[model samples]
Target: MTNMMIYNELTAICGENNVFIDEPMSHHTLTKIGGKADVFVTPQTYEQVADVVRLNANYHLPFMLLGNGSNMIVKDGGVRGLVMYMSHLSSVRVEGTQLTAQGGAGIIHAAQIALEHSLTGLEFACGIPGSVGGAMVMNAGAYGGEVKDVIDHVKAVTPTGDLVILNKEDLALDYRTSIIGKKHYIVLEAVFKLEKGDAAEIKEKMADLTYRRESKQPLEYPSVGSVFKRPPGYFAGKLIQDSGLQGKGVGGAEVSTKHAGFIVNKNNATAADYIATIDMVRETVKQTFGVELELEAKIVGEDLTETAD
Candidate 1:
């Protein structure tokens, strides 16, 4: 399978501990479904990531970046070549009201960091499960607050391995997108400027938001949170509910009867099953509203062979 050659190359670059062969994506992904990545590499620093990129260029090996796996789905057939997980890059530092987060830092963790610094702007992310890199790339927002609103600048490695800093204005963040993820830019870190607030008040607000999220969302189930973006004036969940798609699905991947927005893997659902349910929901929503609801979650990798079962 040319596995040895691939392993040797990876081990030569990042050593044995950092490289994993056929690592299961099910455990890593939020939905807890899918096959394995051919090779999974978790680099601890931006320099290591850059080095990996350079190695990929040398070997002409295929590769892709991964964050928290919240807003994404890898098909049941699994991903080919190198899958670089950003989790190892976690670091969050607050200097006064300004915060700097390593790309792989969870938004929830970043929110906590902000709270520890008595910062108020990151309260919206107190409940988010995505990484700072993914959040920045997608211009992630919730409850009237957005990453774009607070992010002052970002540091990233380009496709050609050039490190650069892009200011907030340069990111061109809007809606659910930014230049980084689109342009194939690899985010290394992000700097956010927040406001000083009472630490007690910040903690109280975060707690309130967390409670509200737990009460409203399907927190117990394994699923990608918020399957679709808000479509202009209408909420995606509301539209699906109004269309009578609540609790409907292709297999074990059922639309949450609790929320109607989330497609949860209630049983041992396959990524194929999850995707089939996603398709059904989209089609039904399109037919009913003629709105052609867009998926917020990123769907990638090869299609499944035994998809029906």
Candidate 2:
């Protein structure tokens, strides 16, 4: 189909207001760097999301799902087909000790809801900057708690746009990884099993975690928090610090002085600059410690040079 046809179809499926052409990916990612997306769609409902997925499948168009873009870095060349932004689908509900949150609901917001209901299990997630779906995809966690520990089940749409309910066992959640991405499942909702606890205690715990995060992380700058996954027997931040990589980077992108694990957009950094900084850190660490540091942040889209070629 032509670009016009695709736009019209997308508008028909969603609405004209929900679709955009040549949308800036920098506006959608945490790093505040990237080019543009050929098409971007904000689906307000689960059915709309499913339909958008099906449409992309039918047209053989490439697509990527976006939550809060908390852990993603889009490249300078931007993305080709569709970019589905799910933030509008956010909704959280509580019943007894079970908290059900829509895919787009902020994980932090869900934690707050749990606290409001005197739920304790989600206290650790109070500082995680991700959407429920994104959290489920990577089993996001902090302060010695993981999403897998509290998630009971998830409702997601498969790559074929068919919905499926997956129990915790089927999710295959591990340290910063899950089957959700491998299976190309777009999360619709998640059910968390939390324990009832004293609201005061929960609030206190959340406050403590928040303080730790704000104090340690480079929250003032734009960044894809925690650049590398922790290697066995060593923390990524400690390793980066040991390598003396902190306070250094390419262009406006720099390894955060506050936390070595973070690569911040200290100035108006380009995606290339950010990626180059990541590479420099990775190479430096590999040479220094003989440890291959795997990335925690997801890199997407294409580079500007590639687009020009």
Candidate 3:
């Protein structure tokens, strides 16, 4: 099938206004550094999302799902095939102690809703910058709390566009990984089982966590949150700081002076620059500390060199 045919089909599924060709990924990602996507579609409803996915499967075209884009970096050459932006699906509701959020809903917003309902479990997620779906994929955690602790179940679409409900046990959520990504499941919604607490206490806890995050993280500059995962027996930030790599970087991407764990876009930086800086940090840390640093943030798309070819 031709590109025009694919565009028309997608437009039929998600409306003409929701579909775009050669959309800039930099405008969507948190790092503000990426190339364009071949095609982008924003499906407003669950049925539309499933239809788009089914169409991609039928066409044998590559498909990628994007949530808040908080912990990801896309390469300069951009992504091929279809990119589904899920922001339109965002919705949150509270019933008693259960808080249910759509996949595209901001995790921070979910925490705020929890606070409003005097729920306590989501206080730790008040500072997380990703969407609920993204958070569920990585089992996002902070300050000794993780999404697995509160998630009751998840509704996800299989790669073939069939929807299924996965209980907490089925999720198999670990430190920063989950079965969802491994199985290529698209999260539709999540039910969080929270406990009732005092509204004042929940608010205070969120405030404290927000303060700590602002004070410690380099939030002024655009970044993909923490770059590397914590190695066994040591924190990644401490290792980088101790290795004298705090102020070093490649291109406009610099290891944050405020937080050694983050590589920030201090100026106009390309995805290539950001990736190179990540490589530099990993190599230096491995050489200095003899520990292999694993990536916590995800890197996607293609490089400029590849696109040129």
| RMSD (CA, Å), each prediction | 2.0, 0.8, 0.8
Q: Rank the candidates by lDDT, best first.
A: 3, 2, 1
Positional deviation of residue 288's Cα in model 2 after best superposition, in angstroms = 1.0
- Model 1 weakest 10-residue run by lDDT: 300-309
Error of 1 at 68 (Å): 0.6
Question: Per-residue lDDT for 20-44 in model 1, tens only?
Answer: 9899888788988767888898888
The estimated TM-scores of all candidates read 0.96, 0.98, 0.99
Could you tell which candidate, 1 or 2, scores higher by TM-score?
A: 2
Clashes of each: 0, 0, 0
Residues 1-309, model 2: lDDT tens digits? 766788899999999999999999889888898899999999888899899999989999888999999999999999988899998989999999999999999999999999999998998899888999999999998989999999999999998899999999999999999999889899999999999999999999999999999999999999998888989999999999999998999999999999999999999999899999999999999999998999999999998888896
Would you list the C-alpha lDDT of every candidate in the order shown?
0.88, 0.93, 0.94
C-alpha positional error of residue 106 in candidate 1 after TM-score superposition, expressed in Å = 0.5
Whole-model alpha-carbon lDDT for candidate 2 = 0.93
Q: List ranges where model 2 is wrong by over 4 Å.
A: none
Candidate 3 lDDT over residue span 191-299, tens digit each: 9999999999999989999999999999999999988888989999999999899889989999999999999999898888899998988899899989899999989
Candidate 3 yields a Cα-based lDDT of: 0.94
- Residue pair clashes in candidate 2: none
